[model samples]
Target: MISYLFGILSIKGKFEYFKMFLVLLSSLPNIDKRIKSIFQTIESVEDIVNIIIGGGAASLEKRASYSLEWLEQNGRCLDHIYSRLSDIPSAGRGAFSRRFIKKGEVVITSPLLAFQKSQLEEFYDKNNKIVPPPDFESRQVILNYCFSHPKSSLALFPLTHAMLINHASVRKGSNRHPNAKIRWATDHTETQKS
Candidate 1:
């Protein structure tokens, strides 16, 4: 799984970098004024970075949601894996899951792919009654395991944020960043109240 995640991120990173390079190249021909062009290039780079960050954040949120859904459905598989290994009475028993979950955490710190809404809905339907959310410490351990394994920071961040927000809202706090908070607050008071 770690390898798979890494493979995906590598491919994505290359594509994103390549796209930015091409965009930069395109602007090179239009820069008749060197100083102005330099500023333009800087602005272009900033725009690209912002796009990547925004897209990455969205992707991460989606992935986290999907991961939670997957866990809900496939928790039994995890339990089974633990049970089988521990029964062997070996010192290494239960170590694999713990290690895997830890690696997942690193992956979650980055951008993630989109979550499948239908899949999430299905999982929700299957588990109609709300169960207690998983423990934050344990959940974090699992996320750390996944994040560390293979995914890029750009791909895991949003997903991780989503999971943390959902499972441990009190701990995670608001999703809005400080910049967003100011904008939202100003808009709410000025427009909505008016």
Candidate 2:
């Protein structure tokens, strides 16, 4: 198969080479299946890639209607946020920056999971903090990714790379301070405003 492809590439005329290459590609077994799988991957992951890499819509409507559902079903953000083993002493996977992020710049636009505290009693501890999953002791804490107040029963959980961010532990003696901060997104279109 490789030899035939090389033969097609060696053809003298450009048009002839292209035509022969197309024919060779079509003759390859499972080519259609491979192509279909590629397109399926693109379709499933398009929205978040667009939002992260292409700066697609961050409107409340789009996040609530599309991004949030994708995250819930896929158990991952649709964006291009990459994760790897954390450099921290006890942490697991941590989100890393793909590009240089300027201070105060919006690095992520995530949708929130707002619900009453009682809705997640099984996940919370007596201190009102979320308990680490039994199987994931040193990973990012689910409660830290959420927003709750002493006076309010509602918790707003951000769904995006924001959830993947692990806090810098002062006890680790790293002396690093948080470089990013989460702020309300108020610039969404009027119809999509929260």
Candidate 3:
């Protein structure tokens, strides 16, 4: 992907340089003035590539260094809880805590990835009575799994460790978890204790 984006023959150790070039060019403070002053106009991808490969190399290197430095300072946001792992004899691993959890406290949060709602709609249009092609339902199940469990961060619900908790429905009037609650948004989810 990086090679494709950079259109390079051998991008040995210069990935960050190209990335910075793109970032700086697109995010120029005064894009119009900078573009006009620099090159008058960018006619084609090949021309841009040539410029990055030649005259803009030094600037790209500088911007890449700064971008990487800033990222190192404030890039990651992790470590929600530090808990112990408990194993059920015949079941699976689960995170447990001996600490007292206060009411309405957030226990876990995860960023959901790009969901495949459009693809799902394309395949299963219930309103029009259009089901996926025969034998496609099984494929869809696999796709959903992949979309939610990709190696990269494109999963529908990436790193859904909170999903390990059983959200079993109650039998009587209510059908939800009694002690814990889960909330979902367009691109993320939060698990809270009530």
Candidate 4:
């Protein structure tokens, strides 16, 4: 299986990402329609690999959504944002910039699926026949386990589902750590406004 996946993506690191991507692709009901909606055509297997697992460039951020060719095909934005496997200490992955970003620049704004604590607790109570809202410690431990071992058991975590927003959190007590901030609202009916 490793060999087959590796063959699909010649890069070893990309092969590893391919495994996670496969997990994401399986959950989507209309995989074909989703792919068709995202892209105009599928030229080859390599094209799929490039489309799915990309952003391994060295010098500058590839500007096609991440490339010169993509910029030529698409146009230009004030700032080009790209996601890649992060190289930060004490980190798994995140987003990065290869160009200057303004003070109050809006990077990305996509709808995210969220479940409230109340609703989740009610659902669990109905299923398990226990009182709603389990103790905080128990819930924390379970959430920690799920987040820590996403590829192990919690395969449905937003990170693996391609729904995670890989924002670089501002490290504490450092002014230069993160100059920008993030603010989000929970309501799905309303689009997030700056």
The TM-scores, one per candidate, come to 0.16, 0.45, 0.30, 0.34
Cα lDDT tens digits for candidate 1, 21-114:
2232223222234222322332333343332333322222222233777667532222211111222222111112223343113212222332
- Candidate 2 weakest ten by summed lDDT: 132-141
Model 4 — which ten-residue stretch has the worst lDDT? 55-64
> Which numbered prediction scores highest in lDDT against the true structure?
2
- lDDT tens digits, residues 1-194, model 2? 11122233345323333333223222323334433232222222233234333322341223434476665663433354455556765454456677776668776666565656554333433344544332231111334456777689766655345655665534436695666776876665553656
Between prediction 1 and prediction 2, which has the larger lDDT? Answer: 2
- Give candidate 1 regions above 4 Å deviation: 1-125, 148-194
* Candidate 4: C-alpha lDDT: 0.37
Q: How many backbone clashes does candidate 3 have?
A: 0
In order, what lDDT does every prediction score? 0.28, 0.44, 0.37, 0.37
Residue-pair clashes per prediction, in order, are 37, 0, 0, 4
In TM-score terms, candidate 4 sits at: 0.34
User: TM-score: which candidate is best?
Assistant: 2
**What digit string (tens of lDDT, one per residue) describes model 4 on residues 81-179?**
555555455333445665776777655433222222233233222134433343454344324312234344322223211222334444455432554
lDDT for residue 176 in candidate 4, whole number 0-100: 27
Q: What are the per-residue Cα lDDT tens digits for candidate 3 across 1-194?
A: 11133434234444444433333333323234433233323334454444433333222322223387765763333234332222434222233433655767765654433444333333322234444332344334324333344455333523333423333324234544445666663332233433
lDDT of 1: 0.28
